[model samples]
Target: MKSGVLKKSGTNKKKAIECLQDTTKNTIVFKIKSNYFNENYIPSSNTRATTNFANLARGENRQENLRNTIQMINNRFNSLAKWDNPNDDRYSVELEIISVEIDIDGSGTTFPSIEVLKTHINDHKTGKRIEGIVGNNFSSYVRDYDFSVLLSEHNKGKENYSIPDNFGELHGNIFKCFVKSEAYKKNFTKAPVICLSVSSNKIYNRTGNHHPVLGFEYLSSKSSLTEEYFEKMGLKVRYFIPPNSVAPFAFYFSGDLLADYTNLELISTISTMETFQKIYRPEIYNANAVAGQCYNPSLKNQDHSLTKISYDREERTGLGIEQGKFAEQHFITPNKNFLEQWSANFTM
Candidate 1:
């Protein structure tokens, strides 16, 4: 009676693991070959970025090449478009990164430190803890968008797009985030739905370089303007800790607990919490919140449903407004009474 064997004598289908990979290699940030670069061109620390930049210097069709390069960059940016799969209900996580600003001293003095920090939620929550490793750790991210919501100016989605895999064991600056299911669901939500993964065991060690290097680099806990900005906005600082390579640390916030905000927003608020703190403090990233999805549970079974409504007229504007409003106003706050009032009156 080996594990995974069906009770009825001979079935071989395995029981699915409760957990799934939320990020994929394609979703995580990485450099791909630019067609402009010569076929043999291999970028490196010794080779100046201009060397690669100059690769696009063509003579007659230089304009065309420039246009193509611009388009290439645009395409990459747009590639983060929210996608949903039509099969699994559980496959509903989006990918996003905490916006961070850092001052890297190219003059060869010291490691780059975070200078500014900004996040998806700025007004509602301020000076909170931020998760994820910063400052020369193994993490990767990319920018993506979703069009399910109608307000072009605001660009509020039903959920905060983020991959849900955490690789705390990796010791180097390079790691991979992977996505598995194309299956997505939409029903007038604001964000895309996809699962992502953070995988580490695969290491790529470069020779001669003392500090570790990989296909990509991950930095954790570097300070950013996001924290200072949040503090300016009136959000309170909860936890602050110095960055550590071996220990776990994170920022936390307590908002008026409302039923409307999705679990994802709450999670991301914490994820970006450390970035909002005025003091440097060590914090532990919450594991459970990072693994959850932020879509409207009722709409998790539909594909192209959000897109369909998005193209429609009257239905699109007012659609999903309740969730959108909740997501916008209540990410991280300290008002428990307000949350109680809203929950008592919530009709939907």
Candidate 2:
């Protein structure tokens, strides 16, 4: 499994401690809850099974939770049906966070500078900027080459670019960053494994480790529409502080998180791959993984699989959610066929 900010058990508890100290103004204590599915501390002997970090770190239930989260969100949007034409039976919506983490600062007895949080939330909503909230003493995660490359490519074509490959190396780097960080790294061995099976090569095994680095930004208006986005739908943002750590967290910086475009990205996997741009899953395309494999490692194969699967093509739908780099984008619209395909797997 790729390293994460959340640990299983018998792991260090410093990061959580530091985070609580920074975020909670009043004296408060927090408990670290491991994801419910984590079972068995030791690894099995099977090579593939041992390597399947997604399966190993997070068992079936946790993965099901994430899948259900996406599924439920899409279902709720379909029920609302305001985003599309009433006549159009097909409708789908993509759900992703603006990606923000609260950095705890020890010694200082206060939450993130209200100004900084306000500015970050504003920047995220306006699609103008994204800044990491790192404490003065907090160290920055050294980004790998692939991580930087994916960001540059995704952000290149537009005034404000979005990372195209979510499941690629970008997610890996972010996980490592969180792992390496002094604040959140403790207690967590790696990020949660949400889903699995996107590239389909069996080369890359874990889900959350390869998940696209999702950014979470606050809504411009805390009014009904935005509040409803979370409150009514159970689309709540994940907020927590690492345990046993100090106060005064650090804020990292990034402009790539600011995505200003008419087109809200559903999933960039398709578009990015079409252009022959690099992807996080080099393993899938790697000479060894693709060489004489059962499925030809190409778009032709993907199209065939997609057709056979017969699922929603409009909304963000796919198997296996990757982390580091974004993948190809799949855009869906209002149509009965679209809605049917999206909900098809749900009842089953």
Candidate 3:
């Protein structure tokens, strides 16, 4: 059994390397910018910050928001997602920004736009890029998660619960443009995973459940509408609330990539989520109130002007309840079955 596991690992490693090589060949590599502003972290003054969907919206400071969020995510992975091997090594994922050429007729649409950015694994630490780490990308809007409109449509009833017709078309085009890119051809022997993070409070179905469920279940159901469109194009979908995360993130891939995750990898992912919660979003973890502080962009001497923001528990749906519930349901509760079968594989 040990030898068989080793052989399977070897095979997976080979496939991963091939995928990485293909990715490198196709991807438009840009040097990682040293500063936040250069990396599109700061938003322009004209950008509008609104509160219609504070939990769901990406806000006017979209780049800054992403910078802060990704920073927390990266830090979480680095700090908590470690492997207790001979070297006591740590694992991390790298995110790269890539632009896809697509024509948008911005006549008078108030909807958010989608951007193509890919997530890659750092090969040196992970050993193989494709096995534990795969090419995952996300489609996000320029200004918001577009939940205000989405929720309104969802309230129209189950028939309209799926992504809006126009929104679906836009995403379809984005995927079409992505597949045509040289990067897509080189990096992916199969379809890359697509992740979506959005607000879930109002979008969820609150009735007819044997047990209480988070709004994510409803949101995932809605996303299934889009998933079907993608599946017809040859992709598979998996949606989850990242452990300790308030926002909804959906992952789409070509095959059973998520199913192949080891128990340790899942634990590491959850550890990252918990770490993120402890720092950026403490309310969910039932921890001390933590606030995020940053230099005010408006000030010329930005370093001197610090702006602190606290996440309000009242404003969010789950607060301290959902994350732990998710962790219990997905990880701890299922561990009994996992342990019964793969007890020896839990070395990490």
Highest lDDT: give the candidate number. Answer: 3
Candidate 3 lDDT at 286 equals 26
Please, what are the lDDT tens digits per residue for candidate 3 over residues 189-300? 4445544332222243322221111112222344444455566434675444443343333455665644554434433334333433333333323232211121111112
Model 1 over residues 36-137: C-alpha lDDT tens digits?
Answer: 122222322211111212223334554554354333322322222213312222111121221111111112111111111112321112333332121111
Error of 1 at 270 (Å): 6.0
Most TM-score-accurate candidate: 3
Which regions of candidate 3 deviate over 4 angstroms? Answer: 1-71, 85-89, 103-114, 122-137, 140-167, 180-183, 187-190, 197-235, 240-249, 259-348
TM-score, cand. 1 vs. native: 0.17
Higher lDDT: candidate 2 or 3? 3
Indicate the residue-level lDDT of 217 in model 1: 21
Each candidate: RMSD to true structure? 25.7, 24.0, 18.7
Q: What are the per-model numbers of colliding residue pairs?
A: 61, 79, 4
